[model samples]
Target: MVKVQQSKFVASAKKLTQCPPEDIAEIAFLGRSNVGKSTFINLLSNHFKLAKSSSTPGKTQLINFFESIWIFKEEQYKMRFVDLPGFGYAKVAKTLKEEWKKDLWEFLNCRSTIKLFIHLVDSRHTQLEIDLQVSQMLEKLCRGDQSVLKIYTKCDKLNSNQRALLSKQGLLLSTNQNLIKSQHGGVETIRLEILKKVFGYEG
Candidate 1:
């Protein structure tokens, strides 16, 4: 059986060279700012504060590496969750914002350790231009060895019909306990998908 044993914050990187030694496969999360990337990561790791969220959007300025351990067939394997800086709607200046866009493209297009891209889109607004563009980009950039998993965040706000329709597009998630189950998706599903993708373990 495959089980995501645990996950922890390893380090933060401002640029590609500053990232820790790329020794293991990585599943990077990419999403627009305020899309609840941090909350999703925290839910998966079962560490509420594993990734910090700010009242102001786009506070995640660095690529955060969260190391996760997997137990399968009585053996342990490792993987990393690369939290790339959120794109769009940041409170930063124009030049810095433009710089961030370049950095993100470089990291995504050139990061060799990346085996999968977890693209999170807000459930309420699935057709945002930036999200659509990013989705297309990831599809183009994906290689034979890589895959893209698009997930919808904050699905609790969606009505029943909306959630049902969204379930067909991809995964739907909400960190809010009172409304998480409404989406019919949760942390375990996300964990299993990551394990299957990066470690080739389905259980």
Candidate 2:
């Protein structure tokens, strides 16, 4: 059984070279600004302070790495969660925003440790042009063996019927857009899905 017991902040990298040596599998989170990526990190750690959650969009301007301890049927493994800078609508200078975009593309194309990409979409709205661009870029950059998961965040605000309707949308077929709320059982469900992806667990 795979179990994530604890997670801790590791380091922030401005570029791929600055990232810690690629020694283990990494799951990177990518999304638009204010899409609750940081909150998802905290949820995975089960520690409110694990990843900084800011009210202001674009506060995460670098690749933040969080190391977690994974126990799979008593065997320990080290895994990483990378919080990539959000792509759109950051309150930064145009030049800086472009630089962030460049760095993100470089990281995605060059990083060897990345096993999966967790792409987050705000469930309250339909997909945006940036989201499609991201999907296209990942399709080109990620290796054939790599994986991607599409997650719709802040699903608690939607009614059951809305969620059901959104879940069946053609665009959400890959990861099935399982609507996820940050609070309560939703976080745990998200975490478990992540583990399922990592460990190839059916349970």
RMSD of each candidate relative to the true structure: 2.1, 4.4
Model 2: per-residue Cα lDDT at residue 187:
50
Error of 1 at 137 (Å): 1.1
Model 2 stretches astray by more than 4 angstroms: 72-77, 169-185
lDDT string for model 1 (109-197, tens) is: 88898999999999988999999899889989998889999999988788789888998989878766766544467776777777788
For candidate 1, give the lDDT of residue 7.
84
- Per-residue lDDT of model 2, residues 1-203, tens digit only: 34677889999989888999998889999988887788777766666788886667776687899998866566665789999888776787889878887888888888988888988888786568989888888888778657887777776676767667766541221121354332223555655566677656566
User: Which residue pairs clash in candidate 2?
Assistant: none
Error in Å for residue 94 of model 2: 2.6
Measured on C-alpha atoms, candidate 2 has an lDDT of 0.75
TM-score of each: 0.90, 0.84
